[model samples]
Target: MKHLAERARQVIPGGVNSGQRSIPGLTDLVITHAAGARFRDSQGREFVDYHAAFGPPLLGHNDPDVSAAVAEAGRTVDLCGVGVTAGEVELAETLAELVPSVEKVLLTSTGSEATFHALRVARAATGRRLVVKFQGCYHGWHDAVSLNVISAPEKVGTHDPISTGILPEVLQATLVLPFNDAEAVRRAFAEHGDDIAAVILEPVPHNVGCLLPEQEFLETLRAECTRAGSVLIFDEVITGFRHHLGGWQAISGITPDLTTMGKAIANGYPVGALGGRADLMELFSSRPGGPAFFAGTYNGQPAVVAAALATLRKLREEPVHEHVFRLGERIRTGLAEVFASLDIPALVTGYGSVFVGYFMTGPARTYDDLLRNDANMFIGYRRRLLEHGVFELPLNLKRSHVSYAHTDADADHLLEAAASAASLARGDVLDLTDASTMGGADAHR
Candidate 1:
């Protein structure tokens, strides 16, 4: 495994395609193949997968239905960059039908593109340049919304851009505020409402360990956006099809002007969608006399579209949500019990099929609250679990997913492994000088 990881590093930056894939303490693993709820590594070791490839594979990896659909699509249709395909129309229509606030839809290759186009449309529609985003809610890697996600404690309320290459004006145009703070939303809207083009958020800030939004906060955003004529965009890339087919808007009863979805929408395929009101979505260059420019060569490749359609069909026909939600609840409850038994200060949080274990006291409703989390303990516990044949990302605040293929027996096995992992992690934490405090030394280790 180390030899392969070294070879990968010679070719790819950081031995992984995504920066997040390079965990600090855990050994680098090369997965061989996957099916159902488990996968085999290069060493031929099997483990139950809770990472779910960062919340894709909602129906589990290598689902026969989705694979067969992709195969059939490959045999019949391929990319036709010049004109539209039937699969594109079907996927767009399916998105419009499933989502309540989506009157029209556009396809993209990734969530980042979907969000980028959504913001562009909002700016063009309102003729404004500024956008409002919460501190911990990550929209994408784009310059407009790339600031202040999982920021350091000192950089919490400041203009903490993730990368250095972003222009200063781009960072200044984005207003960063705390999540679940209705008064903050009101204050921002009162001061800069006229200049604000959009207010984008992850309704539930799952990026920072599932900080559930207060109902009043969402309501305030909707009301303020309407008053100012600024577009409201819910970046549901993490919560969209994972929570409900209609997205979080249906569950919250607070509709936004636009919504961005990806991840589980296509069960791990490369596909993304931007959907919202027809008047707003029609601003794209594809429409007759529309001014906003939008173009992508691989926007609706036939095989990817087929995978998305198949995933959606199974989600509608089968008991996918029910099964995954049940497993999620069991895991969350079991984790809480395990941590409580060990007398560790932790909070188990999630909604639907997502779960996160934060080593903190009480509930976390905002990024500020998450500052109290014991980062060392959180990572230590997850790394220990990884050693015990249960796979979850060792990074703190990253949520774990439960897929449709996971069963009650798998949940039980996870809990049992978690018990042992927690005990070992507790000892490791005790060895640290500042074990009881946040930001302990070597926290990432």
Candidate 2:
């Protein structure tokens, strides 16, 4: 593993393609392959996967149905960038049918692209510049929304960009506020209502563990955006298709102007979608006087579209949500029991099919409340779980996903591992030399 890590570092920056993939101090795992709920590393160690590739493998890694669809699509169709394919039309129609607010849809290669275009549509439609995003909700790696997620105490209310190269003007255009604070939303809109083009957020901020949005806060956003004529965008890249086929908007019943979706939409295939009212989405049309521009070579690549269609069909036909949601609840309850038995100060929280164990006291309503979390213990416990053949990212506040492929037996095994990991964490027996230094706020999805 160490040799492979070193080899990757020689070619790839930080030994991983994505920044979050590089584990601090520990040598990162070179995953050989994955199927269903388990994956094996280069060292021949098999672990029950809860990471779910950062919430993309909703049906599980290498799901046969999605793979078969991709294979069939490859045989019939490939990328034809100039014209649209039957698969692309099917995907857009399916999204419109499933999502209440989405009358039209646009495909993109990744979630980041979906968000980037969504913002463009919003700005073009409203003729405004500023965008409002919450503190801990991660939209993507884009400059407009890539700041202040999982921030430190000192940087909480300040303009904290996750990366360095973001222009000062880009940072200044975003208004970052705390999640679940309805009053803050009211205040921001009251002060800068006309200037704000959009207010984007994850209905559930899964990136920083699941900080569920308050009803009042969501209502306030809808009302303010409606009154100000600002586009309301729901960045459901994490929550979409995982919680429901229609996304969180279906469950919340508070429709937004636009919705950005990906991650679980394709069962690990690189495909994302931005969908909304026809009036706003038509702005992307290259008509004679269309305001917004949207173009991508791989936007509706055949295989990816097939994979997404297959994944969505399976979610609709099978009891995927029922099974995964049950397992998620089981894991959350079991973890709470384990921590309580060990007398550890921890909180187990999540929505359907997602769970996070935070080493903090009581309910965490906002990112500011999460600052009290025991970062070292959170990292150490997850590391111990990794040793016990339960694979979760060794990053504090990173949530675990329960996929449709996961069974009751898998959940039981994870609970057993969690019990042992919690015991180890309580005893302070794990070597947390580097874990202590890996700040909770630095690593995000």
Candidate 3:
């Protein structure tokens, strides 16, 4: 057992919250140092990290320029958390420039806080209480958004309670609808449209393992939210600065009233930003009639903001996403071939830099499609991948992160290991239901 696990278990709850890092057998391999997509675990095992800390390290781990910027900012942090910093304004303005819809921006320490404050603005601006969210699209674990992330196995569209600690009053304000179902959205709006303060969602649903939105669904959401006088928020915490300098909204071209960004903005540093049109942001303005007050000690830490500035500047010039997309597709296609060779039912999801393996029967278009996959087998595959020096975690597993540090060479190496891991997992599945334990030398016979 990794010593960190024993040490961490005594202090941190769950040892570690990152699903990929906290595997049952191998928290010891949980990485001590990382740079440019490769990590060295405590035991000196190496891995091409795919879970870029669940979605932030867009510039890859330990980028020199970002590190330098953070260092430079350290010199001036005498002003950090002291009050206002030019670094904050610069990062905010940078976001406004990159994301055309963002005329004003606010910073927070984490995505949950960003969403929490953004939601407050949404409600106070509209003078409404209801908050709409799509099932399987996770915004954050905040009380307001902690419900109905996925429907129950027996039913679609019905909201399933995820966390029990959420207050009943908070749950009452949440309205969870099935993803990509415009009709369900329309019906919700038809009933409580006027009361819905905002509709917050991940444009590309990553919570259910990197599921993409159906064609025109995002456009329809923007249109619906506008017509209903409710704000639209894109929780791009995972997507921001991920695929490109513009991110998913830039690529998708479906702008929301507000967008929450973190993770990759600073390449693993803690930073989150809420940005949107000036008028909507006016709700957070300090005026007496404005929406609410939002502030934090580390909300705009110079080090993190500087890191973001460096990452963004690099993204504009380097075009690393093209490489990430190509490598991502390579991994997906390679995994498909591996599954086909073994006749294991599985599929790949995600675009550009991010990708996820769905151990399901068919394409994971909706939550129902996701149900056809074998969760246990996926978990087993995750364990085997770690054994093979290719680390991975289940989608149902808590947030995992990956980045551009992985090269084509790394992708090939991972796929080669994945083929063996998939075969091993298929063997385990065979043992589960048979009398003969007949998943022979090759297993699944």
Cα lDDT tens digits, model 3, 219-297, are 8888889999999998888777786566678888888888888877888788888889788788775445665886677
True lDDT of residue 196, candidate 2: 98
Cα distance off (Å), candidate 1, residue 270: 0.5
TM-score attained by model 2 = 0.96
Tell me how far the alpha carbon of residue 412 in candidate 1 is from the true structure, in angstroms, after superposition.
Answer: 0.4
Task: Give the winner by TM-score.
Answer: 2
Residue 241 miss distance in model 2 (angstroms): 0.7
**Of 2 and 3, the candidate ranking higher by lDDT:** 2
After superposition, candidate 2 runs with Cα above 4 Å error: 286-288, 429-445
Ranking of models by TM-score: 2, 1, 3
Query: lDDT (CA) for every model shown?
Result: 0.87, 0.87, 0.73
Candidate 2 lDDT (Cα, 0 to 1): 0.87
Candidate 1, lDDT over the whole model: 0.87
Predicted structure 1, TM vs. truth = 0.95
- For model 3, where is the 10-residue window of minimal lDDT? 436-445
Query: For residues 73-105, could you state the per-residue lDDT of candidate 2 as single tens digits?
Result: 999988877878999899999999999889989
